[model samples]
Target: MAEISGVVERIWRYPVKSTGGERLDTVEVDGRGLAGDRLYAVRDGSGRLGSGKNTRRFRRMDGLLRLGSRLGPRLGAPQLLDPLGSPVEDADAFLRAYLEREDVALAREDAVPHFDQLPVSVLTTATLDWVRAAVPAAVVDERRFRPNILLRTPAGTPPFVEDTWFGREGRVRGGVRLAFVRSSERCAMTGLAQPGLPHAPEILRAITLAHDGRLDALATVARPGRLRVGDAMALA
Candidate 1:
C-alpha cells in the first residue's frame, strides 16, 4: 500500500522557457513534461538559449521573468503576455524592446526537452512556509521557484520532505506515476523579481546556507496521464 503524503494544490506550465507560466486547473503529463511546458524559448543571435541563469548571453537578464506565455486556442501556439496581462502581437519585437536586445528571437525546442533540470518539478507548501519563516519580510510565492506541481502536505509536516522522496515512486489520482529523481538545485533566477513580486536575494541565500541550495524535488514521468488540482498523491 502507498502512503498518502499530500494533495495537489496547483498545476503550472511554462509554455516558454524563462517566462511566467500559466496556472492550470488540470494538465497532462508526458515523458517530456506537462504537454506544452518549455516548448519554446528565446534564443540569442548566436543560437544560444536565452535563460536568466545563462549569464553569458542573457547577462543575468531578469526581464524574461516579467513576461508570461499562454497557449492559444490552437495547439503548439503560445501567445506572449506582458506583466500587466496584455497580449503582445509581435512577441519577438516586444521581447526585444523589453530586454533591450536586438539579437534575441523566440524559438521552439527541438528533439530534446528545454527544461533546465528534469521534466517535472514538485514543491510542497511546507517548504514554502519554512522558507518564508526564514525570511519573514520577503515574498516567497511558488512562482519564484517555477515548479510544475505544488503539493499541499498535511499540517505539521516537516519542510524539505520532498528531498526524501528521491528514488520513490508516486502515483497521482489519475493513475499518473512519477519517480522522484533528485532534489532540485537552486539558481539565481529565484532571486529575480517577477511581475508583482519584488526581488528577494535573501531567499536564495537562505537556501544556500541552510538547505544546501536545494528546496524541491525533480521527477520523471513513469506513467503518462492527466493530473488535476486537489488530486490525491500516494508514495510507495
Candidate 2:
C-alpha cells in the first residue's frame, strides 16, 4: 500500500452550492454532505445543472454571487443570497436563479443545482509546487481550483501525491475513504480573478501545458464522513 502524507490546512464550504463560500477552520460533515458546503445554487429554471454561464454577462454578477450559512442548515435544501449572508430562493420555484433577479427562468421539470458531480475536491501543496515548476508563468494557487480539502505536505515532495492510486480508495489518517479519480480539468471559471486574491492562470493553460494540454489530476473525497486536519492519506 502506497501513501501520500499531508495535513488539512484549510476548509471551505459553498452555502449556495455553486456560488462562492466562506472559509472555516473546521466544520461538521454528514451523509447528505458537508454541513455548509454547497447548500444553495443559482439554477437555470429547468431544475437542471446550473451556474453563472449566462449570468456572467452581467457586470454586477460573476463571482459577485456568494453563499451565506447564517440562516442555519437546511439539510439538502439550500437558500439563496448575495455574496453576503442574506436570504434568497426560487421565486418561480425553480432550481436555478439569477443574482439580481428574484424570479428567473428555471428548468421545466424537477432537478437540482449542485457543485460538480464529485462530493469533495482536494488539492495538495506538493502538486501546486509541481505546477509552478512546470509552468512558471502561472501563479499556481488554490483559489484557481476551489478545492474543499487543502492538504499541505512536508515542504518538499513530488507531484500528484494522490496519483499513487490510479483509481482506488485512499484511507486517510482519520479513516475516511476517498475514491481517487482522474485529474480535474480547468475551465474559464478558474481564470476568473478572485475578489482580493492575486491573479493567476485561472484557465487550464498552466495545467494543460504541464500535462501535455491535459488538465487532469485532482483528488476527491468519496465518503467524506470523517475527514479532518492531520489526516494522512494512503492508497487502500
Candidate 3:
C-alpha cells in the first residue's frame, strides 16, 4: 500500500524562463509539466537561450528576475509584468530595456518546453530547513531553486529525503503520477540577486559542498491530472 509522504504546500509555474513565475492554488499536470510553465523564453542575438543557468548570457540579462510573466486568457499567450508589477503593453521593448540588450527577444517554446533538465522539480521543506541551518545568512526561498511543487514533509523528517525518492513513483492526491528521475543540479542562478532577495554566494556553495550541488528532485509526468495545494502525495 502507498503511504502518505507529504502534502503539497505550494505550486509554481514559470511562463518565461529565468524570470519571475506565478503561484497557483491549483494547476494541471501533463507530460510537458505544468500547463504554462516555461512556455516562453528570451532568446539572445546569438540564438542562445537566456537562462540563469547560462552564466555568460545571464550576466548580460541582469534583472531578468525583476520581470514577471503570467498566462493571458488565451493559451500560450503570456503577459509581461514590470518590476513595479504593472502590465507592460509593449513586451518586446520592455524586455529589451530590462535586459539592456536590443538583440534579445521573447520567444515561445516550440514543440518542447524550454527546460534545463527535467520537466518537473520537487522540493521538501525539510531540505530547505537543512539548507537554512547550513547557511543562515542567505535567504532560502523556494524561488531560488525554482521548484514546481514544494511539499511539506512531516516534521523531523531527515533532510534530503527526496533523494531516496529517486526512481520511485509518486501519486498526487491519488490522481497525478510522477516518476522521480533524479536530483536536480544546482546552478549559478541560485546566487543571483532578485527582488527583495540579496545575492548570497554561500547558498550555492553550501549545496555544492554538502549536497553535491543538488537539492530538489526532478520528475516526469507518468499520468497527467490536476494538482492542488494540500493534496497528499503517496509513493509506491
C-alpha positional error of residue 127 in candidate 1 after TM-score superposition, expressed in Å: 0.5
After superposition, candidate 2 runs with Cα above 4 Å error: 2-4, 31-33, 48-61, 64-102, 105-113, 132-140, 198-203, 212-224
- Give a tens-digit lDDT track for model 1, residues 1-236: 79998999999999988999999998878877789898988888776776777644343556888889998545467899998989999998988999889998788888756777788999999998998899999987899899999999999999999978999988988879989999878888888989888989999999999988998889999999999999989998
Tell me the TM-score of model 2.
0.69
lDDT-better candidate, 1 vs 3: 1
lDDT of 2: 0.55
Residue 132 lDDT in candidate 2: 66
**Can you write out model 2's per-residue Cα lDDT over 88-179, one digit (the tens) per residue?**
55524322343445444322213432545555677778876776676576556675567777778787666775566548766665556666
Clashing pairs in 1: none
For each candidate in turn, give its C-alpha RMSD to the true structure in angstroms: 1.5, 5.3, 1.8
Measured against the true structure, the TM-scores of the candidates, in listed sequence, are: 0.95, 0.69, 0.94
| Model 3's TM-score against the true structure | 0.94
Question: How does residue 210 of candidate 1 score in lDDT?
Answer: 90
lDDT (0 to 1) per candidate: 0.87, 0.55, 0.86
